[model samples]
Target chain A: MPIRRLLVANRGEIAVRVLRAARELGIQTVAVHSDADRESLAVKMADMVMPIGPPQAAKSYLNVDALMKAALDSGADAVHPGYGFLSENATFAEKVESAGLIFVGPTPEAIRIMGNKSLARETASKAGVPCVPGSDGVVDSVEQAVESATRIGWPIMIKASAGGGGRGIRVAHDADELRSQMTTAQAEAQAAFGDKSVYLERFIRRARHVEVQVLGDGKNAVHCFERECSLQRRRQKILEEAPSPALSADTRSRLCESAVQLARSVGYRGAGTLEYLYDDVSREFFFIEMNTRIQVEHPITEMITGIDLVREMIRIAGGEPLRFKQSDIVMRGAAIECRINAEDPDRNFMPSPGKVHEVILPGGPGVRVDSMLYPGYTVPPWYDSLLAKLVVHAEDRPTAIARMRRALRELHIEGVKTTRGLHLTLMDDPRFQAAEFDTNALEGWLAARAPAASPTTTTSP
Target chain B: MAHHEVLSPLPGTFYRRPSPDAEVFAKEGAIVKVGDVIGLVEVMKQFSEVQADAAGKIVRFLVENEDAVEPGQPLATIETA
Candidate 1:
């Protein structure tokens, strides 16, 4: 079905991203926001802005009923979850579909399969994708976790069976630590993901986090190479680069093939990311999980492949076939992305929320900044701290690094503390340049270069 | 006697206290001053303190604790005196 009017059931940068894509397709966009985001750039840019509820996401963005009502009231033919919030909520997807409004995502069943990590692991295993050795089902008790750890061996990772974004994960080296971490992990998992079910996996230390972007038309799927997102702190990716430096040509091809196989196994549709942990020393890659929605680091893939993923998602939702064949796809150059957040990385990444007095974005060749910020815009404390994503692409890794550094230096936002300085330092680090790091690299780097005592704290000017 | 307008600045679940069974920040018939913390509204993970911009006596409570509210949703009617 062709989507005429689309209601974006999200806010902030992603709302703007979806709105921009919809506008390009000549679709009217309806933006739903909390009371706090009445003046947000997304609301201002959208064709119509409706108040979903208050600032709380529960009453606003995640309120499936409110979103459906808004879509109905606005005469929107489709609803886009735009990542996070209820983006992966299967019930919400089904409700959207049942309400006669097309959901701009995968099938509700696909969302259900991927939302549960254990089920996804099983699905990947069935599809011949390598997965970490761990429990095949949910571990409901500490005893089960300990037994699983003993069987899978120590240094096991306890993760929420229905978790993502590093929320319900705990790594334990011994039985005692495993027991304690299991409780904490379960509690956090319940609070964050609304699921207390936990599972175990053999922890793969020093693993490079790589993921392939895939698009499917519910029948066939195509892979968009791989992106290295190892530079993360607290399990959140801070930087991402396409055409991972760690992957050999053979490994890259195999990884992409595996991702395609997995996508085909589920008859996946829309934009999805197949995440894997690649061990450099072992040269083995294991499937982690799949994100059944548009990813935050999609810009890097776009920079390298020159494919508008968002546009393609809309097309696929409209029942279009795969736009291009596998042979037609080509990765042109290395692309890097640095997530600029409104936080003081020097001070434990505490959120720095306030008004943006002055805003300056990077430019020049290969530089792309996706943001929803403007002067006098208030960085609301009610949402994610990401202010913008700075992406750059060049002929090679070194050139891409240089471009990213230049972009970081050129980027400026006054009246709010940002992680721009941290990105600059990371781009200049020798280890980062050599690509000899793992997911823990950022945390180690920060620990080694701890900000000076009494670091200067700035507020919105 | 003077008249004052009670307005909600943001939308969220309005709570009269930090938690259930806890004393509310303000009550009906209580004299309130400008800038007084009258209630709390949670949006996402952040909790915002809704302050009274006009001094008056809270004559009527318009919303119950933990009630879902929208921006400009009336919380309490205040009578300036």
Candidate 2:
């Protein structure tokens, strides 16, 4: 059955993205918001506005009962958990379906199977997807972790089984450090993920972060190719581009095929991403984890493939088979996405949440801004610092970079600090231009550049 | 007595009461023992109790109930013994 009305179970840019897609598909859209987000762009864009609760996400976005109640009261037949929040939450997915509402993502089983890091690695191993050598299962004790580290070789990653978005992890390079870091890692995991159980994985030094986008209808799935997300800080991606800068054609094919294999093995539905850490030295890629929701870097894939992933997820939720098969999907052009966060980059990326007194968005062909910024809008202090995503596409990588530089220069937000200046600096850097940087590139660049940069906040004119 | 500040360890909404139906954990000028839970900071839906690290009397909260707080933001002042 097709969805009559859809409720976007999220806020910010992604919610606006879903509402736009829903409009294009002629579906009525409902926006759920916290009190702080009542004046947000998503609320203004939505066909119907529903208050989930108070300013805190716990009382609002993360409140499953309130969300379901809002969905029911809004007459929405389907709910789209637009990445993060409850997107990969298995119980929330189950609750959505159990309440007779269509959940516009993977099934609860896929989420449950992939949301758990240890279980996900096992599933990938069984599906013939290569994974980082690690403990076979959850490491029970310090002795078990030490044993696994010795066997898997030193420089191991102690990760929380339920960790995602680059939290609940610590890297250890020696036995003594391993023992010391293990306790801290477990405590951090317990505090962050509500799970103290962790597993160990061989840490790759200076690895490139690559991920493949895939769509499924539970029975069949296809890959939309890969994205290179190597320029990250603290394991959180800052910039991403489609058709990995480092992978050869053969390597790309293998990586994408492996992601599709994992998705198919899990009988996945809707849009999901399989993340991998690619060792540029050996040309070997190991499956890291599967993100069972639309990724933040999805626009780059959409720009290159000319596919609307959010729309596809909605269609798949409506019982529609994928319109295009593996053969029909063609990747063209190169797209680059820069995450503009509301942070003072010169101030060690401290959160700079404030009212957006003014906003100037860039335009022109091949440039898109997925954002919810408007004048008088307050970038709430209660949530993630992401202010907007600026994406640019062109015939090739250099052109894409050039376009991104121009687009970034034209974009501006007043009354708050943003990451735009850092992105502009990256665009002009030789290493970034040569695409020779890895996940540690940003941290290194910032360290070297921090001393020379003045304390004054630099805003784009 | 020196005034000691109690700062939030993370960013979130600060709560004066434990819950809606519960009483406020502490009141201004109330004597507090070391390591006593005085309030809570709710971030990402997780409640972390704001404990008084020093024995003191409450000197009023810097933020209102349900107000958003940030890491290192002063929650309250304590008149340390």
Candidate 3:
């Protein structure tokens, strides 16, 4: 049956995104919000609003029972979990399905298999996808870890079996450090992810973050090329650009093929991203993880391909078979996205949640702003710091970069300090202008900009 | 009497108890010791216990049972033991 009404089980710009997609598809939307979000833009845009619970996410968004009750009460037949806060939760998906409502994403089993990083790596390897050389599974002990490190080479990454968003990870340069850090890493992983199992991988230096966006129909999948997301702050992506300047034509094709193969192997559905750590020295890429939901940086892909990813996900959830084949999908031009967060970059990227007194979103040719910001809007401190996503598209990478720079200047926000100034500095930096930086670039850049110029990271990469 | 503030570590909602069905961790006028959990802060569905780093007598709570809170927001006051 076609979805009559959809319940958006999220907040922020993503919530607004889902509401717009549903409206385009001629489906009604029900917005569920905690008390803190009563005046949010999503609540205003929604056809109907329901109180999920109190301000706390546990009693609100993350509470499966509360979400179900809200969906049922609002007469919604489906739930769109917009990235984060139970978006990739397997048990939540199962519960939604058992409640006789459509879960707008991949199958629960697929999520389960790929949610565990070690299991996903093994599955990717079995599907003939290239993975970073490391332990077969979670290392049994420090002795086993040492042996594996010797075989895998030096500079290793210890990762938790069930970690995401850049948590539960430690990097060691030698066996002595690995042995000393093993207990600490395991304890951290256990505390953070509730899973102590840790695995090791050959940590590649001078790495670029490349990921392929794939849409699957449970039988096959198609790739929409790749996005270079190497510019990150504290391991969290802050900016992304499509058609990476680093990839050769041959490497790009191989990357897409590998991503599609892995997605098909799991009978994936809806939109998913296969992330990789690209070695700049060897030009080899290894599987990192798979995000089984729409990513925050998806607009850059959409800008170049003209494919509405949110609409595609809604259609797939509605049981429509993905019609486009590998040949049919085309990627043109270059797109870049800057995540404008409500953070004071000068103060260690501290969250700056307050009332948005004034707003001026850049609008011109090749510029688009996906935001939930409005004058007099109070950014609640109960969730992520992301306030908006500024995206720009042009015929090529250089033009895209120039357009983004222009948009960053045109954009204006008041009342709360933001990363806008930081982005401005990055856009003007000679190194960033050449795109000659890796995943660790932002940290080095920030350190140099610091008044003290901490000795920990002096030379800005 | 001088009171010590028990500030929440992160933003979310302040809970006076572990769960909805449980009793409040500490009551007004109750004696509390260092490292004692006075309340809970719920953020991203993760509950962080608000421990009394300084021993004190439980003063009146400042926030309600499920009021929204931000980082460093005072959840309650603790009088010197």
Candidate 4:
């Protein structure tokens, strides 16, 4: 399909990102916003703005009918679901196609297959990709969980088959804990993913979270190398870097190749990320799940490979083949990205949404800030607190870390409390600098350094 | 002593009347009891009625038809009769 006018069925930084890319391609953009985000940056940047609904995400971003109506009403030829919200929703993808608007993503079948962790694992194993040792199907009872755990060995991880973002996952040390954790995991999974299907996997303690970016046009696929996203809190990636410092040349090659193989097997098209849990000690990587949308950490990959992933996705959606072959791809300098959020890390990462009184983005050699914030811009409280992404690229990991620390120090945002101070502290931590950390590193580091008393609380201007 | 505030339970586009030509459900000087349908808010193509939870007189209409409202945003000010 030749996408002329595009309706972005998302909001915040991603919406702004897509609008910019579409505008650069001479594609008219229609931005849909909830009542809370009527005056948001994305709405202001787009050619046309439509009100989807109110502040609640269920009534706005997740409303497939409303999104389709907006696309139809705005005369949009295609709908682009940026990451999060309804981006991975197979039903929404199918509905978009049925509504006659080109869904700028993978087919609904691909989404459905990848949306479920258990099914995805089966698919990966069939494709000869190493999958985490786990059950091949959903575990319905405690007995079933225990059986799977015994087969997979003790210290197994119970995960919601339909879950993501670290939710609906419970690590059990023994049988008793597994029994209790299984029920909790099931309840959480049902509440969060609307699917109570739970599965078991051998938990890799102190494992590094790494992922490879892949682009495909169903028949052809290419890998954009790997990103080390070990820095996480509550199962959400807080910081990510490309050209993972932890991987050797051979490991990196194998990881990328595995990701490409899986993408080709699924007939994957558009931009996707093949996530894996890497055990540094064993030097083994296992496929976790595939995110079938533009990722928040795509900038790091873009910096290292010089590929505009969003542009590639749009081109592929327009039925274009891979513009560059695997041989043409190159991974250069290391790139790091820190998510700047409208939150007070000192206060348990509580959101501090308000107006921006002053804004000064870091600008120096290898420093890049992707944001839509300007002085006097109000941060709405209804959506994710992420305000911007601070990205830096250098010839090596050490240089990239140093550059990120410098950029963070130079960057300043006022009128709301931000995680800037926390990011600065994290950058200065020796463990983080050495990249000798796991997914749990951030939480432990923060808990240890947390103030004896309530940390400095900043109010809105 | 009594206190009352008319509010919306869900987020949507606030509409003052059933239709453009119809009389508004509530207006200045109009008295309403608890559970009275004061207005309608359209969310995702579904129109949900916003009811008055207290017995009062409509003192002021804080929002007009087609106004985008958030959850708990006051749609009208109701003064206890």
Candidate 5:
């Protein structure tokens, strides 16, 4: 059954992106908003609007009951969870399907299996996908941790099995350090998560964040190459590009094939990304996890592959089979995306949520700006600081970089202090041009430039 | 009663406690020192302490815990020292 009306269960740029795609598919759109987002671009663009709750995300966007009510009341036949929020939530997906509405993503079972790290790792291993060497299960004692660490290698990470957000995680390079950290990790885990179970895994230094985009229609799956998001801060990807400059043709094929294999193993459907940790020196990749929804940096992949991923996902949700086979899709060129956030980079990237005075978006041959910003729009502080994503594509990486530099120059937003200057500076940097950076590189680069800069010194130039 | 209003420094959600399971930083009628943390204003996932500018007794909290606040919005009221 084709979806006639789609309820967008998200906010900000992604919500707008989904609404546009749905409209393109000749589907009417219903945008659900909190009190804070009544005047949001997405709400304005939607065919119908439903007031869910208040400004707090818990009471609004993340409120499953409120969203379902809106969906049913608005007569929406399908719901598009536009990344973040509850996109990867298995229970929410199940609820949507149970309500007799299409969930524009993978099956709930696929989401559940991939949601747990250990379960996903086990599944990947069963499918012959390489995973980071680690303990078979939770380590109960120091002896068990040590035995696993020695087998893993010299530098290993002691992590609380129950902990998240990098808490109760200790990286130790030797046996003595591992022993000392193991006790503390276990205790911290017990105190934090009330679970003393801890695990050990090899710590990869200078690891690159590479992920392959795949589309599946239950029976078959195909990979859309890979994206390199090594330049990150606080594990948040600030900039992204494709195809990975670090991957050789043979390695890229192997990596892409592995992702397809994993997707096929899960009997996946819709759009999903399999995240991998790539070691530049060793030229080895390890499957870390899978995101069972469209990713934030997905536009870069779309730019290179010339596939509207959101459109494809919507088509798949409408019960269509894989439109294009692996042979049908071809990657054309390099693309780069800079996440323009409402943040003051000079002030340690402090969130700058206020009125967007004058908006001058960069647009030319290959530049695309995905944003919800408009003149006189007040960005509410109740959510993520991502204001826009400026993406550019060219014949090659250098040309793409040059196009990005030009696009960034043309881009200008008054009133709010954005990360435009930081992106501009990065564009001129030789290291970034050569793509000689890792996951931790951006934080270090920001720290090195911190001392010379003072608080709230706007770098808008 | 002479009262001074404690304002939120940034526009975001105001939390009276540092964490969910903790007690409110300042209780009503409790004496607090200047620069004492009264609440936390979370803006775009970044938490910053909302400090009491005046040493006095907290008359009452102007906003409930987890309320959406704007810059310069009164968070609490304090009796004069």
Candidate 6:
């Protein structure tokens, strides 16, 4: 089926993003919402609206039964799980497919194989993709972790086997530190992901967080180059840009090809991103894991490659083959995306959720504001803090930076604190301009700027 | 006895316990002091301790566990000496 009707099983800006793509494709859109999102922009723009459940995500968005019922009730032939919630969940994908509705992403097997960190590493290695040297599988005990740490060398990272997005990670430089942190890491992992199993990997110092965007049609896969997402806070990417400044032309080609090889090995379908750790010192990259859905930073890639990734993913889900060859998809101008979050950057990046009294989005050529914000819209605290993404493209990185600075200045969302100031400061940062930072750079920069303070009060801004 | 109502300082989801497996921070009829954590308000994934502003015995919690809350909303009532 060509997806005559689509159900968006998510909220926030991504929901609006999907609605726009569906509208352009002439697909009837159905927006599913919790009680808190009844008056959301997505609901207003959707052709039909369905209330799933209460405000909590568990009773609503994450509830597979509720989502499926909504899909069927709204007459949607396809369901778009827009990043997070159930987007990468293999069971959810299986359920959607078994229910005779199209899931706008990869096959369930691919999601299952790549969702686990240890298993994904094994699969990558089997595909001849370079991966970080680590333990063969999940470390059983603290003694076993210490044993593996010695072989993997000191400064190993204890990562949750079933975790992603930097959750349940602990780094130890020596045996004593490893022994002490091992149980804590396991407990944290179990608490966060419902899995206590963890794996050890050699922690790469001064490594840039690079990921290649790949699209597949179950048989053929092509890379859309790479994105430099090194500027992150606590493992969360705050800013991202396509065509990494760290990679040379030769290295970039090899890195992108390895990502495609890994995707092909898994028989991936739709759009996905292969995350890698790029060591600037050795000029080598290692595949860490693969996100089997449209990433939040997909827009920057779209800007540079002229490929609407969300649209392409939906088309692929609708049984369409790859539209362009590797050579046809060319990276043109440099593009950068600044994540405009509802956070107080100066006050330790505390979450700032409130009603928006005013909204001033930037315009003109090369500037795009992808957001769900509107005047009188109250940002509920039940979801992620991301309010908008200010994306800008230019001829080169420097010009892109300048354009981003201009756009950031023009963006003014009143009533709630945002990361606008932080991004503006980054635009002027020499190290950021020179692209001389890694995954840990943003945290260090933030800590230096404002020393540790007491825990944030529950006072709303 | 004087009665005092503890209001939620911020809006979000309110949880009586620190973690899912943990017990409630302060049960009803439990004696609480000023600045004692009675619950937690999670706003956009960041948790902030909901502290009682006055020393008293908690009469009852107005909302159930994991209920949505708003700023200045009464969460619990305390019977003070």
Q: Give per-residue CA lDDT, model 5, range A118-147, as digits (tens).
A: 678789989999999998767888888888
After superposition on all C-alphas, the RMSD of every candidate to the true structure, in Å, is 6.7, 5.1, 4.9, 8.2, 3.2, 2.2
Per residue, candidate 1 scores C-alpha lDDT tens digits across B1-81 of: 766666656544678986565688988889999878888875434356778878889888788887766668777877886
Of the candidates numbered 1 and 6, which has the greater TM-score value? 6
Regions of model 4 farther than 4 Å from truth: A179-193, A451-461, B1-81
Better of 4 and 6 by lDDT: 6
Which candidate achieves the best TM-score against the true structure? 6
To one decimal place, how large is model 3's interface RMSD in Å?
11.2
Give the alpha carbon lDDT tens digit for every residue of A6-45 in model 1: 9999988888999999999999999998988999989899
Tens digits of per-residue lDDT for model 3 on A1-461?
67889999999899999999999999999998999899999999999999988776778989998998998888888999999988999999998899899999999999999899999999999999999999998996999999999999989999889887777879999989999999999987777777899999988878999999999989879999999999997688999999788999999999999999999999999999999999888999999999999999999999989899999989889889997889988889999899999877776665667889999999999999999999999988788889889999999988887898899999999998898988888778889889898999888888778866442321101
lDDT: worst 10-residue window of model 6 chain B: B43-52
Model 6 spans > 4 angstroms off: A452-461, B1-4, B29-35, B55-59, B77-81
Relative to the unseen true structure, what is the C-alpha lDDT of residue A14 in candidate 1, on a scale of 0 to 100? 87
- CAPRI-wise, candidate 4 is incorrect
| Best model per lDDT | 6
Candidate 3, true inter-chain contacts retained: 0.24
Candidate 1, DockQ score (0 to 1): 0.11
What is the Å distance of residue A200 in model 2 from its true position? 1.6
- Candidate 3, residue A192: the lDDT equals 72
- Two-chain complex of model 4, DockQ on C-alpha atoms against the true structure: 0.04
Decreasing DockQ order of the candidates: 6, 5, 3, 2, 1, 4
Task: Write the number of the candidate with greater TM-score, choosing between 1 and 5.
Answer: 5
Candidate 5 CAPRI grade: acceptable
Give every prediction's interface RMSD: 7.0, 12.0, 11.2, 13.2, 6.7, 3.1
Inter-residue clash pairs, candidate 2: none
The parts of candidate 2 lying over 4 Å away from their true place are A141-144, A175-192, A452-461, B1-66, B69-74, B78-81
Clashing pairs in 4: none
* lDDT, residue B22, model 4: 68
